[model samples]
Target: MRHIQRIHINVKSFICPNCAKSFKDNDTLQTHIKYIHECERNFCCRECEKTFVSSSDLNRHTQMVHMNLRRFLCSTCGKTFHTSSNAKRHFDEVCGKKEKKNGNS
Candidate 1:
């Protein structure tokens, strides 16, 4: 309940000593330290023999690299991209405001 409360309240109690990043829960903080700082790749892809620090990353790599799944498509040019962020970037370059520079619109 305390962990859930921290997330809802946006109170980051656990702070990483190495990078000074904050997490709402201890488990997330520990995972960040293990994966980001320690570079522990627990999940591995057998097909490509590549390792990922997290399972979701391994899944994304398998879908994009091995399966060649480009789910996101740019509406303007009809270009395909593996990630939604890439598609949105292409869309912004094509139709919307130019890609952000120095965090400005």
Candidate 2:
């Protein structure tokens, strides 16, 4: 058997002074400040009181709940979906759906 040497370590170094918060990564600490205390919830849902950081999320929620509009239709199966990607996925994986020549399915 080989002999091994032990080492001592001191790893409690990075601390946030403003909130007495500590993180292993500085980017996490900055994200906490920007997201939690900056009052920058840019995306607000129209159907409910939910808030998000991106507008795409709010638009998705609005399309799902408030508008209830389905723009995607399967050509062979005659199934309707809210988003084009979902419709395409169903056509490829689900059943009986074919893509039109114009790719409108």
Error of 1 at 90 (Å): 0.4
Clashes of each: 0, 0
Q: Using TM-score as the measure, which candidate wins?
A: 1
**Which stretches of candidate 1 lie above 4 Å from their native place?**
1-31, 97-105
**Residue 92 lDDT, candidate 1, scale 0-100:** 73
* lDDT (Cα, tens digit) per residue for candidate 1, span 5-64: 775688888999999998988899999888799997889998978999879999999999
lDDT of each: 0.84, 0.70
Model 2 CA lDDT for position 89: 85
Please give each candidate's TM-score.
0.56, 0.46
Clashing pairs in 2: none
Task: List candidate 2 segments past 4 Å from native.
Answer: 1-39, 96-105
What is candidate 2's lDDT per residue for 1-105, written digit by digit as tens?
A: 111211133333446667777655566777777766674777888668799777887887888778997888887778899988899889777663334544665
